[model samples]
Target chain A: MYRISYKAFKFEAKDALLYRIDPRAKLFVALYSMTISIITFDLTTLILLTIYLMIYISLLGKILRKIMRNLLVLTPLIIIIFLANYLVTFNIITSLVPAVKLITLVLSMNIFFLTTSPDDFSLTLEKLGVPLTITLAFSLSLRFIIVLSKQLNEITEAQLSRGYTLDRGGLIQRIKNFIPILVPMIVLSIKRSIDIAETLEVRGFRTDVKHTPYHDLKTTRRDVVFTLSSIVSITIFYYPLQDILSLFIPL
Target chain B: MIEFRNVWFKYDEEGDFILRNINLTIKRGEVISILGDNGSGKTTLIKHMNGLLKPTKGDVYVDGENTRDKPISELSRKVAIVFQYPEKMFFSPSVEEELKATLKNFGLEGEELNNRLEEILEEFRLVDLRDRTPFSLSGGEQRRLSIAIALSWDPDYVILDEPTTGLDGYSRRDLTKTIEKVLAKNKTVVIVTHDLEYLFEFAPRVILLSRGAIVFQGSFKELLENEDVIMRNGLESPKISMLMKVVRRDGGGCGMRYSELLSVIIERLGCSEDV
Candidate 1:
């Protein structure tokens, strides 16, 4: 019942300063960091930003551990990105730039998703003038990801219980073995989508009406402090700070 | 026999236990019903029997083999679990191909595979729909096909998780017949369900779980006898059982089914009508 509230990004109800910041400020930080990480190609600056993210995460209490766990799952993707960049550029230092940028982006966003509640994030979107339907669509897709992963796990178990061995065969045979799992997944996914749509209708969901949010969002001093620090950190990446830091810390 | 010896399980190390110290035994050929409210670990218990999940603290033994020692595929040769949603198990192009795939997975081939395929299709009344894709079949037909796939390999223990969910009266009757067939084969069938009426009809041995502990386990008649156990667990007794409770309060004897309950009520009223 509480899977959605607690399982998404392993959000914890903490008393930390990061948890107290306005979700709108947190969202700006996450998206802005992602934008900078994509545009800026300096490997030294990226690594320094990654270090800053790690330090920032440590200040949030035990969330650093959870963030590391999420990043571990993305290690393979990071390696693939690194390899692809290396094959094209043939420069070790240049290849490290994209990988370091991904780590920084993931770390920065993990702070947002881990600290902010789903309701708060949706409200942030609405506060920024997004339509209710679009916000619901976005939030529902994120929520259903947990459901889909769970369904996939159950389907895999069901197939295994039928004595189906996925790892025992040749490449062609192994790919063929996935059919039993894939078909059921597709069928269940379709059924789940229909059920969700029906539920929305039954619950009187409408796209035409305006909604009054229950909780009033208030931006406190912590949010202001967080936003200022985030802006300062973003600026530090562009100035003589990068030049000075690159001399001290070799890439 | 399936033995759960002090079995305790949690999904992760930091998570709370879902099944705690569940020391229970299910003998061969015995029809068992596992009852519990949602999140009380009914599905988790059945998953343990099939070796799909391993107990975190203790051991589960199926047919003298420790589940912790065997892979799920190896343990599944002895235990077949038909999940609540049958659609999650279908990936074949057609119903016949589905059965053939399961049989082939069990290492059957040639004439034996073809024979088992035809036999299962005929038994489940899927021979007519055998050419249809599983996704195209009706809900009841899909359920039947899923059960047929499970039974085709002839496992010693068959577990049905909420087999009656979304099934109509006719489809439930079909499920009853299927359960009867499984029992007649002398195979142990375990049903994890919330359908009390279905359980009353069969009156199988029941294990009631609450808060990760087995609160009650005995014959269904004994379970009905202890209305407090059922009520305390926030589960309603089957309607017939509730009606009989009123009858028994007014000096009627025990009965589980409708026919038996009718005779008991008539005897208590001291009236008989010729039909």
Candidate 2:
């Protein structure tokens, strides 16, 4: 059974410096890293981004452990990506490149999510002029990950106890075996969604009304310094320093 | 027989133990009811019986074999678990197909499979709904189908986790009948439940757990006699039981059943002749 704690990627109320910084700054850092990760095929750049996020995570105190634990959940996808790439190119280093890029992307995004509460993240999106509906959807999705994973765990255990072997079948048969697992998951998801919709309706949840943030988010001097420094360093590295590093790294 | 030898478990390495020093023996052909409030390690305890979870500190032995050394699929052949939500396991196109899928998992096929399928469909009263999708069945029918699927493989031990949860009066009665049928087959039935009223009626071997520890384990009558253990564990006795206690405290005597309490009330009111 997968005993994944629901609090792995959740934001905790901590007295760390990361929590003091504005969610907007964290969002920018995450977005900037993701944009760079997507735009560049350079392994050195991705490695550098990974190293930068690692430093940022360490500065947030003991959150790196939780972030690493959550990353294990992505291991299967990483291996699949590596195998698909190696099958086509037959180059080990080239296969490693995409996997490293994916890791870097996850590292950056997880840092932002771990430090920002859903309400704060929602408010930050609203501050950036996004629609209220989209912001609420994003926030609710983050909260729903725990619920969905828990439901998935329960369904898997229920099936396993009925003597259903997940590993007995060939590729097609293995996929077919998941029908017993997936059908219940979908049914439960629909039921839960209906329950949630009814709950929200009863609580007077509406898009037409302007909803205020539960906690007022104010950008302190720390956020300004952190945001400006991140932008300046990223611009300097992406434009000039990246070329210098690429020469030495020989990607 | 199943045995837990000083078993202790926690889902996370750094987390608090969910089941602490749990040592109990479930003999063959006996009914065991695990009683606790929510999160009192009731479900976690039963999961160890089927090798779904291994003890973190001690050992659990199923029929003299260590659960830690056995795969869940192998142990599942000896133990069947019916989870609280029946819909969480239903996936086949039809009710009959769902039972067939479970039976096939245990290596049954051909004539034997057909016989087992027919038997389960008939036993659960699902013959009329055999061709219907499991999702199309009513709540009680879906519950019976889930139990039927679990019992399709003819496992030696059956675990029902919150079997009566979200069930109506008639559905609860149907579940009681199902439990009686399982016991009649000489299967060891273990139930994790909070339905004390139903427990009072069924009166199985009650094991009370409090904060991951077994506070009491005996017959249902013994549990009612010691109300302190029940209250200390954040549980309330059945209404009939509470009423009996109240009457006894007032120097009046009553039994732990509704009919007994009713007769006592009539006797105390001096209205036996009026009835």
Tens-place lDDT digits, model 2, residues A1-251: 44545767456777787777888888887788788878878777777777777776777644788777767989999999999999999998888889989988888787577778888888898999899989988988888888888888888899889887777769999998788888988887888888988999999999898877668778888888988887777667666767888777777
The TM-score measured for candidate 1 stands at 0.84
Place model 2 in a CAPRI quality band. medium
Question: Which pairs clash inside model 2?
Answer: none
| Worst 10-residue lDDT window, candidate 2 chain B | B252-261
Chain B alone, TM-score, model 1: 0.91
- Which candidate number maximizes DockQ? 2
Calculate the i-RMS of every candidate, to one decimal place.
1.1, 0.9
Q: lDDT per model, in order?
A: 0.84, 0.84
Number of the top-ranking candidate, with TM-score as the measure: 1
Candidate 1 residue spans exceeding 4 A from truth = A1-20, A34-48, A60-62, A76-99, A117-137, A197-222, A233-251, B245-275
The per-model DockQ list reads: 0.75, 0.78
